[model samples]
Target: MKNYKSYIIGLIALVGALQSCVKDSYLEEVNPNAVSSDNYWSNLTESEENLTSVYGGLLNQYLWNSEVEALRSDLAFPRERTRPLNYGYEWHSQSFTNTISTHYFKSWNALYRVIWRANQVIDGLNGMDETFKSQERWTTQMAEARFMRGLMHFYAHSTYNHGEIIIRDKIPTSSEEFSKPLSTSEEAIEFFRTDLQFAYDNLPNTQTQKTRVSKGTAATVLGKSYLYTEEYDLAMPLLKDVIEGPYGYSLLTGDDVSLLFTHAGDYNAESILEINYTDQHARLIQTTDSWDEEAYTTRWARYTAPTNLGGGGTSYFVPTSWLTYEYSNEPVNPNDSRNYISGTNIAKSVPLRCAQMIAVVNDEESTYYNKTPGYEATTFSGTVFSHFKKLTNHDIVGHEDEVLSTSWASGKNMIVYRLADVYLMLAECLIQKNDIDGALGYINAIRNRWGLMLLGADDGTGTFNDVTYTKETLMDHLMYLERPLEIGLEGYAERANDLRRWGVTKQRFEALAAKEYNVVNYNYTKADGTTGKGSLIQEGPTVNVKTDVNTEFDDAAVNFIESVHAYLPLPTDEYLYNQEVN
Candidate 1:
């Protein structure tokens, strides 16, 4: 069992206990028995307890619990064959219509919940006794709260609300305070930097509890914030620090790379920050309140797993044909033995990253949901079909056969930030700075992990594998090649952010829309001695955009208005409630 204790139930019970302390006697001028923030925040224990609640807010539906980020990117498509097409179709197709309003509100609301709780903890910590404030525990907790606040603001600005979000620096005491005006992107990033800088300055290089944020986490995020705003000069130092720092971080290699998504990989050496989940008491009971429901587990697996694989998964989102082709497009390292399909003399197949990412047919080397040797059978055939395997526990155990009664909940922790991402980000920064040679090392470091051919004649062989790169070529490789393969579908809207940042969202989508996809079925013998579709390859009349039932092929090519869709609109509730926003 995971040792890190998430105070999910403890947070709920504590809030209930405190609220019970309210004594509103009609005759009293002031209730001495009241449990206000002033009285309750008497020491470090209270601060620590409240901080845990702030962390709990990360598991919200619009946050880590779902793949809203992936749905928005070209990397994933909503499984249109499944029901409730409205879940991701709007964002996936970039419709941004009245149908998507609730999604916008939920996203805005969830992120702010984290920001508000973080602000509450910060305010409480600030108002505590002076001696307590002087203690090391107080400083550390303050940094943690600040880190969360800045991080959430960054998410709201860059990911969801797109810089039209209000910066909630403190707990609001009145309606006016709560309804503050939106900050410009510059104002928001500046506000976020102060908090993140404090966090980077004060946080330990490493934490006793793997779940807690550390110095490396703060640095990487702070650098990322700068990178997002195009402050490449400002971003370079911080990212470089993470690359060379004594944070004890390194990339997981070989078969161990498969462990990155499993329960056993939680808080591994590569991970900088992770949202921890557990199945010790996984429950199926759903509540109207998002925070109160299944605090120790996530529905990410059930939502992303392949439905046809007999896993009881909803198959809400699956890897796009574009993404699969990108993996296949990667140049195979002929020297490496792992590059080939098992039991096949064919020298090159999809690399290790592709095998780890999605289940493919006739792959005797990889496993899918206890189906050893490969995904030999699935109901999804005749059309090109592949489901996400990265975030789901489809390799370790079948979703239906979990120890818990519920099939929806999973204990695998979500890795929000890891060393590979930092390496890629650093490479991007170096490329932007015109240090093309400087950037190749960071990029090649990732390639070296899979024993793939290095770029730009860096390898001693000097053959260059017929691949030579200039500054422009290297940057192209960084954006389209390195970023997608390594950190593609992993984080919060990572691929979407990259597409937007590179000014290629519309182009990328249209390109994907134009491509044709195909399905190939391998021959296999049944127990009854019947031969299945043997070496049958079917060309798709289907294009990528129409893969999702809700999306029109023309929608991606025509309806994607880059100016409006690139940055999502602020929630309608913001205009409805905030006097200053309108």
Candidate 2:
């Protein structure tokens, strides 16, 4: 909960300076003019500082805060398909080529940089005196470092690369150590599991800084790794531990759910691990005009805010119509009075999460930017009628141009893992384990928070909405609906990863392409209890029929060759520089 962004800022600068001097290497370099490996690890303070640098990798906007990762998935796509936006959208169309390096190189390099930093801390700690190394502080920091190192490898190998990845477990001092061949998939998972196991065994339940990894964080991520590798039995108990552990993590409900992506929600009870970004941008801006002032902040808002609201023109990645329609299809919470328009039985017609996650031009009634009259979103991108409201200060900031009115680099922390994600994963595992009854509880907990209809009916009917519950049916709901609705547009390419792991990427896109999304004329009650009609895109007669089936979706469905597109290739420069790669 403490402000550690300043420490992250300094450590990032140190890591950059160290990396700049290293030629044709992936490991951290020892600079003759600066602190060297021989003297840097003398005390606990220095080791902890290096560990902070490991967490700084999460601040890589290209990886987390920006749309680079999300855009790779089906949840979002570039608002404009211009040449400048080619790399980001290429992942969708399966036209990926290493010639365009901005998205590919930055994200790949960022993951490895964290791995290198974690390796630096682990190596430095291993070199300390036996007496010092045996202390609680040393063990804890080592556990933290290994946790980070393992998580990065998980990202590089399992999440992004989807195959062999270099296992940089130690700092390379010689040329032989500098270049290593990629580890086999089996070897990579083994190394990943081992590192996370150590962290889980040694890390304490709590940390002085909440941003640092804890026992629950290790368990959640380690459990997720197991899920990715098809070790459902192994994943079940670990995820359960975090669910029923001493950690006080719980789901954020009601208004708090809407605030999850805003600055106020940073380090909240549901959050397991989050990257710390400083909220002192206003004060820092006054002191200097240099980049340091914005160094600790994230430009996520500047990139994700709607173009109408002054977001970057080149990278305007909005939520795809497929995603918005998916969220809209959630059964309205019939029991909640707020779901109904004032003095009428008519429901607002959009689900609670749809209102919270994206701005539907016509369906929403809430006061956007706190305007006098609600539902103020004027336009969206292309044929898409919704814009991503998550990770933007649209609601909190009292202005039409939220990103421009606020700091250039916003300070909202990016949450990597949370309790809701764990619940959904548990449901997934439970369904895989054939515990249909048990899985329903986990899935329904998420729905109950929003007062939406539960998956299964009461009285042990194993039915909801007159549909019988089966393992396949429940799995389909969790896989296609619950997971994307609850945690979409959050996490690190999780939607894309989920589709791949389920072996349904092409099928999912095909289904999305075939489906028709109706942009209906709807009505909502305004703040003053007056009726307001929203007909942003009126259809032919009664229903405005709009198929979200675009060229992007059509191309992705047909051209997404699993061998080539399922996994991102290692940056070309990596093979060029590393002799072992050839």
**Highest lDDT scorer:** 2
The positional error of residue 486 in candidate 1, measured at the CA in angstroms, is 1.5
Clashes of 2: 1
lDDT of the candidates, in the order given: 0.67, 0.70
Q: What TM-score number comes out for model 2? A: 0.88
- Candidate 2: tens digits of C-alpha lDDT, residues 219-338: 999999899878999998899999899888888886677667666677888999877765464345443222342245666666666555656645567676667666666775567766
Q: Which stretches of candidate 1 lie over 4 Å from their true place?
A: 8-35, 80-86, 98-101, 160-162, 283-294, 309-315, 340-349, 377-380, 401-403, 458-464, 520-553
Clashing pairs in 1: none
Model 1 weakest lDDT span, ten residues long: 16-25
Locate the minimum summed-lDDT window of 10 residues in model 2: 535-544
Question: Candidate 2: misplaced stretches above 4 Å?
Answer: 5-13, 17-22, 25-30, 80-87, 279-282, 285-294, 338-346, 372-374, 380-382, 399-408, 458-464, 518-549
Identify the candidate with maximal TM-score.
2
Q: Residues 323-345, candidate 1, lDDT per residue (tens digit)?
A: 66566556655666666655766
Pairs with backbone N, CA or C atoms under 3 Å apart (clashes), candidate 2: 539-544
Clashes of each: 0, 1
